[model samples]
Target chain A: MLDRDEDILKAAESWAEVDKGVALATVIETWGSAPRPAGSNLVVNEDGTFLGSVSGGCVEGAVVTEALDVISSGAPRMLEFGVADETAWTVGLSCGGRIRVFVEKVV
Target chain B: MKLATLSAINTERAARRPVIVVTDIGNGEQRLVRAADIARDPLHIELERHLRMGKSSVIEVEGRELFLNVYAPTAKLVIIGAVHISQALAPLARSLGYDVTVVDPRSAFASPERFPDVRLIAEWPDVALPPLNIDHYTAFVAVTHDPKIDDPALLHALERDCFYIGALGSRNTHGQRAVRLRAEGVSEASIERIHAPIGLEIGAISPSEIAVAIMAEITAQLRLPKASTA
Candidate 1:
């Protein structure tokens, strides 16, 4: 629950210290029974490591897995998570919620 | 960069200028000072106030007049109910950047065991509220319809000018409460400040849905211009 600007700056500061490229993911929208609200944040490092979350353990593993791709590619990407997704079966939540996450690298 | 921005915001807030502190990520350990004037700076400045609320306020560069309004991120929501609605509300408000505290007089309901990571106040409002210092930035909601509990808290909230005062009740119940307040000589304007029917007209039935509607209304009110909206 950090604010949008604060989370980005924190990621940048931490990345600067470790000399790792930082990628940020934000939940811009959500559907029924979503665990986190819009504006939820997650920060990822080049090593495929991350801090914070965009879902309640339901979609984070996928997000982190994709975030690593965003960091390596250095390109902003948008991801979707929900019951309709074929990979949704992998995570535990079955409550039928959808979330849209926007990922970008902070320079 | 941080010190200068903090100083700028401090001066503005001390001079009664409205400013907002923007912080990022979880745990709220990082922040930047943001204002109409300060936002023009090249480097982002994170402004953080002591959580102690109302103590020493320091702005450096002695003897210069700067009009600044330092807003403390988002105001807090203090709820006096532990029902299912609160279960949805605590996390929602936290996401919206409000420091949320849920209080229930019943020890069975108020325990931290039930509400993980949420600040729970087991004491009654009269006892618990003073330390919290409910102010203009604070919004209070009393979901428990019990007069013994909600009434005393309502009185305290009205007296303290807590910004948004609300209670969960029907039109009939709120009407009766209004009558009681009038009999006690509380002004009509003051009684009107309470969002009696509570949430917006979303026809919410479930507790979580009700929570969403209430939060949406509060958020809308918080964003509106004070004089125009009132």
Candidate 2:
């Protein structure tokens, strides 16, 4: 967790230093067969560039889209995706698990 | 998510201090909390529990959900022998995310060429262990059969709070070691903590297999319940 998550934080610092809009998405909770465990992070820039992962590859696109909005709005968003949810197919979390990711602009 | 807080987290991590980045999901507010500061923090009790376990987790405090991004110092493996088993053990421990240090007074065995990319301290255990600052996250393994070398290292490891202390020897040798330690005024309880015939009984014969067994035992000691290990 430290090794990879540290990389994410370091990347965020670098991006922020360059004046790029930045947001951080963190997997706050997971239930049953979640690919990545809770506390996994995905750091995103306004340009759609990112580092790290909250879910292996499943929910990253949706998280990034929300993160872009978060960067513009300066508001945090909590997103829940799972196979049981209606948007599961849309978000591609067909792995039979639930994950709650919180995205917030880095201040 | 302040840059100052992120910088503080990096600084604390570089210093090998246990830290937690507590993020309030609702408000997007975050603060860096070091292990030293956890006691005075409002979430002291909860923070300390996660700190000891060395795991990042989420918890609720007064109806607010907070993410605790724990950053404990990487666990350390301090090998006392620099022998064949140490060769295997160092890399294995490194792969398991432990910062490994190989200690041996013998320059021939503790050469950089022999253990490339690994920290080597070519000093006797009594002279070497003090500076290493052995702590709870450390796993101390005495692979050198020589009592002169292994005993002092064991004494130092026991005195400190090393989570695992394993000595490579037969049961007979460990019995003799027990007598020697007792004579040296080391307590029975402290002596009992030593995992003699180190490693799980996986019938390991070669050095690599022995290293695997030792690592497995250390992992069990690290992750399992005390009653289960007992």
Question: Which predicted model would earn the best lDDT?
Answer: 2
Per TM-score, the best of the predicted structures is 2
Fnat: each model in turn: 0.03, 0.46
RMSD of 1: 11.6
Judge the docking of candidate 2 as incorrect, acceptable, medium or high.
acceptable
What ranges in model 1 sit over 4 Å off? Answer: A1-107, B1-5, B8-17, B20-71, B227-230
Instruction: Write candidate 1's Cα lDDT for A8-98 as tens digits.
Output: 4455555745667777676756788888766566777787767787786788888888888877887667788778877777763477888
lDDT of 2 by residue, A13-62 (tens): 88887889999888888889989877678999999999999889998988
Output the TM-score of candidate 1.
Answer: 0.53
**What local lDDT score does residue B185 receive in model 1, on the 0 to 100 scale?**
77
lDDT of 2 at B200: 98
Maximum-DockQ candidate: 2
**What DockQ results do all the predictions give, each relative to the true complex?**
0.05, 0.40
